[model samples]
Target: MDAKTCLEKLKLIGVLSFATVDTQGNPQIRNISAIHYEPDGMYFFTARGKNFCRELLENEKVQIACFEACPAKVIVRQPPISTRT
Candidate 1:
């Protein structure tokens, strides 16, 4: 599938499984619904005090997956983009 199609599917799915490694190098997974999609990439939100946020800030690497009825699983592996105002 193309990038556009994959993004559309993700948006439609809403919640996604975000996998990240903790400070101990242990795997962690959680369902996240706060997401925004762009043509180039996607964005997700997590509370600053949450383990998810800490993991992302510490590791920067993450894998996002979404499973639908047709089993269209999309695994995105990339470092989080930092934007400064």
Candidate 2:
């Protein structure tokens, strides 16, 4: 599907489940129910500075996976903001 189609699907499904690799190369998967998807990318709300934010800071690269238990769209991008920074 194209970006627009993907976005529409995302909107219909607000929650997203994905994983992020920390500096240690450890895979951390999180189920994010609150996500704000923009044209550039997606955003998540957290405290001013949290470990998850630090995780994003440590590794700008991330994978956001969403699907209908079938075809999955794995999005790879650097979140604009990290919980720590």
Q: What's the TM-score of every candidate structure? A: 0.82, 0.68
Encode model 2's per-residue lDDT on 1-85: one tens digit a residue: 5666676667767577767777688898877888887874556775546566667767667676776655666464445553433
Model 1 off-target regions past 4 Å?
83-85
lDDT of 1 by residue, 5-85 (tens): 778788778689989998888999999988888987787667788888888887888888888777566777768678222
Specify the poorest-scoring 10-residue window by lDDT in model 2.
76-85
Q: List candidate 2 stretches off by more than 4 Å.
A: 69-84
Looking at candidate 1, the ten consecutive residues that score lowest on lDDT are 76-85
Error of 2 at 45 (Å): 0.9
Model 1, position 17, has a per-residue lDDT of: 91
For model 2, what is the error of residue 54's alpha carbon versus the real structure, in angstroms, after optimal superposition?
A: 0.6
What clash count goes with each model?
0, 2
